[model samples]
Structures are given as C-alpha cells and as structure tokens.
Target: MKVAVLYEINKPLVIEEVTLPPLKYGQVLVKLKTSGLCHKQLEEMTGKRGHDPFLPHLLGHEGAGIVKDIGPGVSFVNKGDHVVLGWMKGKGINSEPPEYTNGRNKLNAGWITTFNEYGIYSENRVTSIKKEMPFDVACLLGCAVTTGYGVVNRIAKMESRKKVAVFGIGGIGLNVVQWASVRGATHVIAVDLRNDKLELARRIGATHVINAGNEHAVDAVRTITDGGADYVFEAAGNIHVMEQAYEATNGKGLTVLMGVPKKEDKLCIDPIPLYLGRRITGCHGGDTVKDEDIPLAVDLYLQGKLKLNELITERIHLSGINEAFQRMKEGKIVGRSIIEFERSSPD
Candidate 1:
C-alpha cells in the first residue's frame, strides 16, 4: 500500500509504497475511500505538541472506507461493510497500533490512519454505518461533525435559547455553531478573524458573527449576550483566544476548550469566576461516544439537518496534501477539506 509517511516534524510527508502486514487479532483491513483533513493532524505535523518519538508514522485519523477483510476476533463489521474510522474508541476490540515497513525501515501508525490507499485499523476504531452513505462526506462523521455534536449535546448539555460563542469557525467550530443552532440556542455567535468563515457561520445558523481581527471578541460577545454567553467554546487552539473565551463566559456559565493548544503553552485565569459558578474545562473529541453518537450524527445528515456537505470546502488528491496544509496554515480553507483518494489511484 502507498501511504504518506511523516519522516520528520515540519517536513513534507514522503509518499512511499510499503508492505502492509497481515491483520492481527482485533484488527481489520480497510480500503480507504476518503479521509478528512483535520487541524489536529496539522498540529501533529508541525510538532506543536513537542517532540514526537513516533516519527515516520502514518498521518491521518479520520476516514471512511470499506471493510476489505476482518481478523479473527472482529465481529461488529463484516467484509464489504462501510465504516467510519476515528481515533476515539467504539464498541469493538482494541488492538495494538499497526506497523508497516519498506523491507528495511519500520513505520508506525496509530489505531486508525487514513492517508493511504489501504489501512490496518483496530476494530474498536471502526464503526459500521449504512452501506450507501457517501464516503467523502461520511469522513466528516469520524471527527468534525461528531465532535461538534458531542460538544453541544454531551459536554455543554446546552439547552435551547442559551447563548453560545464559538471561537473559531473551522471544521469543528462551524459544527459547534451549527449544532448550537440546531439545539435551539437563541444567541449563537460565531467568532473568527476571517470574514468568509463568519459568513459561512451565519448560513450555518449563527445568530451573530464577530471578527476578532478588527475588534475585541470578548466585548462583542458580552454585548451580544447582555453580559456574557452561557457557553463559550475555544476551538481556535490559540492560548490568547482561550483566555478570551474564558473571559467571555458568563459568571455562571461553562467554557469548553475544543482546540488543542501547544504542549508548553499555558493560560492564566482568575478562580473568582469559579467561586461565582463559572466552569472551565477541555474537550476530548467532544467527549463523543462513537457507537451511539456517530449514528446520530449520520441520521441528522441523512435527514437533511446537519450541514455536512457545506463543510467540505475542497476535495484534493492525496498528492496535494502538503498544499492543503499550507492553505490550512493560511486559514484559506473555509471549513474542512477531504483527500479524495479515487482521483490519485495510488499503488
């Protein structure tokens, strides 16, 4: 199989043909149809979280594919089933991460990876959805849509008419704003420095939009919410934005951190807000229980409720991945981009 290998941090991934080992217990082999390009992968690629001992590893975590084969212990999915591959654990068996090789050098991969023609993923990381679901958009359910839905439903438990301020309208942030609206938040505010993203957010159901580039996000949010928002989500992964999100939360509201910050980065906050009933915390994939939540997200999409189609701003071949990353760094991607492998026809 041909896979993009991360040889070093802040370096272009080397596309190489490597031998995929036979599936082990609790593992399954999948022929990837599409993969979602996530900022989390960008963080990993740039070594944002610090030293990576797992160099020369596979590069993606969210994808949709077909079950080409199943190992001995696999039971949830059968051959030819359509499934979503995600980093979060689901109902199946949890096997060890897979390893591939070029006959000389060993390559590492996590439980799930999709930036390749084929992948050997743990059964627990694969969830079978309807066979007819489109692979390209279904890829979003693996992370973006699921995380945002989980954030609104599970983490914040945000009720209708609550004020919500999402501090980044990218893939996850856009979903957060969309779900916030779907959940009936009367004052759903989308915050970003980019006008295109803010405009997209409005179409996605944000009652208000704030450009932090020109004005103060905290002040804008406060003014819109009449003091502060009930829920403030920091999805931009910026420490300064996180602090602002914290400051923008109502005295008795919840602030959820949806973006992954640098490992050495820290944010200062006053505990007095907590004393007054304010709560601040972080999210792990929006605390999504994939087995239950993924299906729900899929249902919403199938019912023409979730805006999965609009989230895909670009569809690039795997060879153009580095350029995609550059676009992401420049904030050129409005929502999310998908790596459509069919066009590449990798060996």
Candidate 2:
C-alpha cells in the first residue's frame, strides 16, 4: 500500500509504497475511501508537542473505509462492513500498533492511520456506520463532528438560550457552532482571524462573527453577549487565543479549551475567577465516546439536522496533502480538507 510517511518533524511527508505485515489479534484491514486531514496531524508534522519518538510513522486518524479483513477475536465489525476509523477507543479489542516495511526499513503507525490507501487499525479504533453515509462526510465523524458534539452535549451540558462563543472557526470550531445552534443557544458568536471562516460560521449558525485580526476578540464577544458569553470555546491551538477565550466568558460562565497548545507553552489566567464561580477546563477530544457519538452524528447528518457537507470545503487526492496543509496553516481553508482516495468505491 502507498502511505505518507513522516520521517522527520518540520519536513514534508514522503509518499511511498510499503508492505503491511499480516494482521494480528483484534486488528482489521481497511481500504480507505476518504480521510480528513486534521490540525492534530499538522501539530505532529511541525513537532508542536516537541520531540516525536514515532518519526517515520504514518499520519492520520480520521477516515472512512470498508473492512477488507478482520483478525481473530474481532466482533464489532466484519469483512465488507463500512466503518469510520478514529483515534478514540470504542467497544472492541485494543490490538498492538502495526508496522510496515519498505523492503529495507520498517515504518511505525498508531492504532489508527488514514493517510494511506489501506490501513491496519485496532478493532477499538473503528466503528461500523450505515452504508448510506457518504465516506467523505462519514470520515469527519471519526473526530471533528464527534468531538464538537461531545463538547456541547457531554462536557458542557449546554442549556438552551445560553450565549456561546467559539474561538477559531476551523473544522472542529465550525461543528461547535452548528451544535451550539442546534442546541438552541440564543447567541452563537464565532471568532477567527479569517473573514472567510467567519462567513462560513455565519452561514452555519453563528449569530455574530468577529475577526480577531481586526478588533479585539474578547471585547467584541463581551459586547455582543452583554457582559460576556455563557460558554467560550478555544479551538485555535494558540495559547494567546485560549487566554482570550477565558476572558470572554461571563462571571459565571465556563471556558472550554479544545485546542492543543505547544508542549513548552503554559497558560496563565486570573485565579479570582475560580473563586467567583467562573470556570475553565480543557477537553480531550471533547470527552467523546466513540461508540456512541459516531453513530449519533451519522443519524443526525442523515436526518438533515447536522451540517456535515458544509464543513467539507475542499477534496483533494493524497498527493495534494502537503498543499492542503499549507492552506490550512495559512487559514486559507474555511473548512475541512478531505482526501479522496482513487479507489473510493466500496467494491
């Protein structure tokens, strides 16, 4: 199979053909139909979290594919089943990470990898979805949509008519906006440096949009919500933006940090807020339960209640991944960039 290999940090991935070892216990072989390039992968590519012991490893966690084969002890899915592969664990066996070879050297991969034509994922990393669900959009359920949904419904337990503000209107952020709207939030404020993203957010559900590059984000959010938003989400993966999200919350509001900051970065906030009932917390993949959230998102999308298609702004082949990464880094991509594999057909 041809896979994108990250041999070094801050370097472009090398696309090459590699050989996959036979599947072990609780592993599943999948032929990828589509994959979503997430910001998490960009962090890995740039070494945002510091030294990577898994260099020369496969890159990608969210994808939709058909199960080509299943190893022993697997019961969650079977051969020919449509599945969404994600980083989060679900109900199944947690197999060992797979390793591929280029006939000379070995390459490492995590429990879930999608930047390849085919992948060997742990059973717990994949969940079967309806065949009717489009692969391009279903791939998003593997992370972005599921995480955003979890953030709103699970972690925050957001109530109706509450004022909400989301910082960084990217893939995950956009979903946060949509879910916030769907949950009946009276005011959904979208904040970002890119006007295009702000516009996209408006189209989805943001009652107001603020360009952080122009005016002060915290002040604008406070002004819009008449003192501050009830819930603030930081998804820009920048420490400064996370701070701004915290400041934009009301006296009794909760600030949720969804972005992954650099390893050396430390967040400093006023401790007085905690004493006054104001709170700040970070989310791990939105506290999403993969087995539950993925299926629910699929049902919502199929029912025309969830906005998945709008989240997909661009679809590129595997070869164009680097270019897509550049666009995402520059904030040129208003939404998710899906990698459409050549052999997308389930057959």
TM-score for every candidate vs. truth?
A: 0.92, 0.92
Most accurate candidate by lDDT: 2
User: Which regions of candidate 1 are displaced past 4 Å?
Assistant: 261-273, 344-347
Summarize candidate 1's per-residue lDDT along 1-347 as a digit string, tens digits. 77898999999888889997988999999999999999889989999867999888897889999999999899999999999999888998999888999887899998988899899999999999987678989998888788888999999998888999999887889999999988989899999988999999998799999999999999999999999999999998899999999999999999999888878998998889899899998987788899998888788878888777878889988888888988998878887889988884521
Residue range 162-255, candidate 2, lDDT tens digits: 9999999877899999999989999999998888889989988999999988999999999999999999999989999999999999999999
Q: Candidate 1 — what's its lDDT?
A: 0.90
Model 1: how far residue 334 lies from native, Å: 1.9
With candidate 2 superimposed using the best TM-score fit, by how many Å does residue 130's alpha carbon deviate from the native? Answer: 0.9
Q: Which ten residues in a row have the lowest lDDT in candidate 2?
A: 338-347
Candidate 1, which ten residues in sequence have the lowest lDDT sum? 338-347
Clashing pairs in 1: none
